[model samples]
Target: MDSSLVMIGLTNVLSFNNIACILGGTLLGLFVGAMPGLSATMALALLLPLTFSFDPATGLSMLASLYVGASYGGSIAAILLRTPGTPSAAATVLDGFPLSQQGRAGEALGVSLFASFFGGLMSGIALLTAAPLLGTLVLEFGPVELFAIAVLGITIIGSLAQGSVISGLLSGGLGLLLSTVGMDLTTGTPRMTFDQINLFGGIDFTVALIGLFSVPQALTLIENSHQGGKVASRITDRLMPRWSTIKQLMPNILRSSGIGIVVGLIPGTGGDTASWFAYNEAKRFAKDKSRFGKGEVAGVAAPEAANNAVVGGALIPTIALGIPGSSSTAILLGALMVQGILPGPNLLTDYGDVTYTLIWAVILANIALLVVGLAFTKMSVSVTKIPDGFIACAILTLCIIGAFAINNSLFDVGLMLGFGLFGYWMSKAGVSPAPMVIGLILGPVMETSFQQSMLIGNDSFGVFLESPIATVLLILALLSILQATPFFRWLRVPFKRRLKPD
Candidate 1:
């Protein structure tokens, strides 16, 4: 809130060098996000080390731009092919593909691009206003409260699971176990390292991320190479929406952006959840609900708006609480640490200029997205025409390079390959990788905080329950767990039946 710091931040972000970084990052993000089997998180992880050479503000700005661009980019594939470029675009496929099939691909792309820009713009404004205030409030949080928050985050594993709650829990447990493979932080003792010196530091997260996200995708593409054809129908209509259509979708866009912001503020929820919630809300409020899945412009707008808004919303918790709101923000948190910057309450206090610069960069990224998305819509559609063999090889090569670049060690590459196979098997079993990634990211935070809380509480576990904040967080975690279970739905069914008075 310091006037001088704000001015300095604005000046730094607007500089030629930083603007170039933002532009380059946004273009790269669009390419990655428009490709099926690629995700923003993976792209950021792969490109994180490249930012190490830049100044803190410039580096962070680049990552922020990538995040913003990727959030909008996913809609390209969701509309063109039946495949969503990123998981966040899953809801987009419902209406996006239908519209494409009906030869309304251009209209679908226009609505998606415009809605994404509006959502991101709104969320950027929210981030500008909300993060500093949230940072001030969380400054009061103790170790026990932080530990409780971590637990609450972990509970979201059930919501992230692609299969049953049990599967999600198991995957989360596996990640936690993997996290413990390195030397014990409390003591110098090596916990799970089979005396291998390389294992002393544990598996590098970047390596694991590349393996889990990229490798399986490459394998899938290779396996499905036989069914080679154009990815989508030709887009032949106007690339921009009519003013009347835009006016009709304005309400849905606004409503969905609000939904995205709220959901993104909650730890562990991401764009995927926001998009689905927005789509459902749009359907519930529509005058003609039957038009929803069959090429409705509102349907495309609802999800695109929500997913893009999540980029800014997710950054709120990451910047303010040092708690990642989603997997993508988790990678962003890691990037901050890599650059010797710590997130949380002190972020705005110690690095106020840099923080504000990142926020401004997000706004700029959204503006760039609108221009680039509209200009490249026709050209981007041709990307899906590339052969699967070429795509698979390219991804495989990047995975190898990214994994090795993490530590300049072949051992890391081996670990990446091992995890890649494990991830592929997990996918085959219908288990979600998201819960595992969350567990890996949060495991150390939870352990260290709990340990510190125990020391503060004279080694008594009861201290966590004694704190009001911790108690509330723990209760929320419990509720999240219960809500994911079948028993809770069954219990609610009877109550709903009684209320209906049938």
Candidate 2:
């Protein structure tokens, strides 16, 4: 709040170089985001090396710009090509692709861009206002509260798991196990390192992120090439929806933003979960709910707003605590550390300039994304014309570089390739990588917090209910599980029938 710090932040962000960096990052994000298989996490991984040369504030501001831009950029391809540029855009494609088929692609894309901008702007303002308050709350958190938060996050993974809840839990449990690979935190005993010197430092989250997201995409591209696959993008003439259309969708936009913020505040929940929840809620409330799957404008707007708003909302927990809100932010934590900046309660008190700069960066990036997205609509369509082989090779190159750059480990490269195969198989089996990503990112916090809380409770099972927050969270977790069960749905049917006096 000091005048000097505010002045410094404005100066740093307003400088020619930083402005150029933001624009460059946004453009790169938009392009990478429009291409299926090239995710925001991978794009950030590729850009990580470039940040080593800049000042911490400048570098992080640029990265944040790219992060926001790319999340919104994914919707372009989801609408135009019927393929999600990133997994979070999957909900966008439900109505977006159909809009394209109906020759309203331009209007759909335009609405998406505007809704994304508004949602991001709203969330950015929310971050600016909410971060400090949340940071204060973070000061009150200990192992008990932290553990409660982690469990809450894990519960939201249900929204993204897609397949059997059991499988999702298994994948998440495996990730938690993998997170314990390094030496024990309190005790110095090495746990899962196998005495390998490289593993003594633990698996680099960035390397795992790149490997998990990018390599599998590369392999998919190659496999498709051999099968004579084709991809195409088309831009129709209509560029804007009617005023009536906008009026009809306003309610959905607001509702989706609310869902995005709430879900994003939970550590493991991400843009995909926000979008999915928003889409479902929209269907639930719509007058003609059956039209949801038939290219309704509200369908397109709901997820677009939700996903974009998630960029700002996700930052809340990451900045207030050390936990990441999504996979992309998990890599961002490493980036923050690389710049000698740690993400925690002190971020606002100690580094308000950087924090606010990042908030402004989100807003600025959203504006840039809209302009760039609109101007290049036709050119982006040309992406579909690229040879599948070349795209495959290019992605492979990025994956290799991305893996190696994380701690400069050759072992990570092999790890990336191994995970690549595993991811491909998982995709075929209808399993979601998102739950695993969240599990991997939040595993250490969950395990360590659980253990510490238990020790403090003297092995008493009732100890978990000592804190009101803990008690409430555990109850909510049970409710979430029950709500997702078939028996609960069946039970609700009778209640609804009685209420309606049938």
The sequence of per-residue lDDT tens digits that candidate 2 reaches over residues 136-197 is 66556677877776666566564446677666666666677777888887686798888897
- lDDT of all the models against the reference? 0.84, 0.76
Name the regions of candidate 1 deviating beyond 4 angstroms.
Answer: 1-8, 98-103, 288-291, 342-346
Best by TM-score: 1
**For model 1, what is the error of residue 102's alpha carbon versus the real structure, in angstroms, after optimal superposition?**
5.1
What are the RMSD figures for all models against the true structure?
2.4, 4.1
Model 1: per-residue Cα lDDT over 1-502, one tens digit each: 5668667888988999998998888877887788777789878877776777789888888998898888888888899998888889999999999999999999999999999999999999898889878767666687898898778777775455678878887887777778888888798789889989999998777778778877887898888888867657689899899999999999999999999999888766689999999999999999999998999999999999999999899889777766677778877777776776654456777878888888888888898888888887778887767777788898788888877777889999899999989889988999878778777777887888889999999999999889998999799888878887899989999999899965
Clashes of 1: 0
**Top-lDDT structure, candidate number:** 1
Looking at candidate 2, the ten consecutive residues that score lowest on lDDT are: 227-236
Clashing residue pairs found in predicted model 2: none
Candidate 1, residue 3: how far the Cα is off, in Å: 5.2
In angstroms, the error of model 2 at 310 is: 2.8
The residue ranges of model 2 lying beyond 4 angstroms of the native Cα positions read 1-12, 45-55, 88-105, 158-160, 226-256, 262-302, 321-323, 337-353, 446-465, 474-500
Q: State the TM-score for model 2.
A: 0.82
Task: Please report, as a residue range, the 10-residue window in candidate 1 with the lowest summed lDDT.
Answer: 337-346
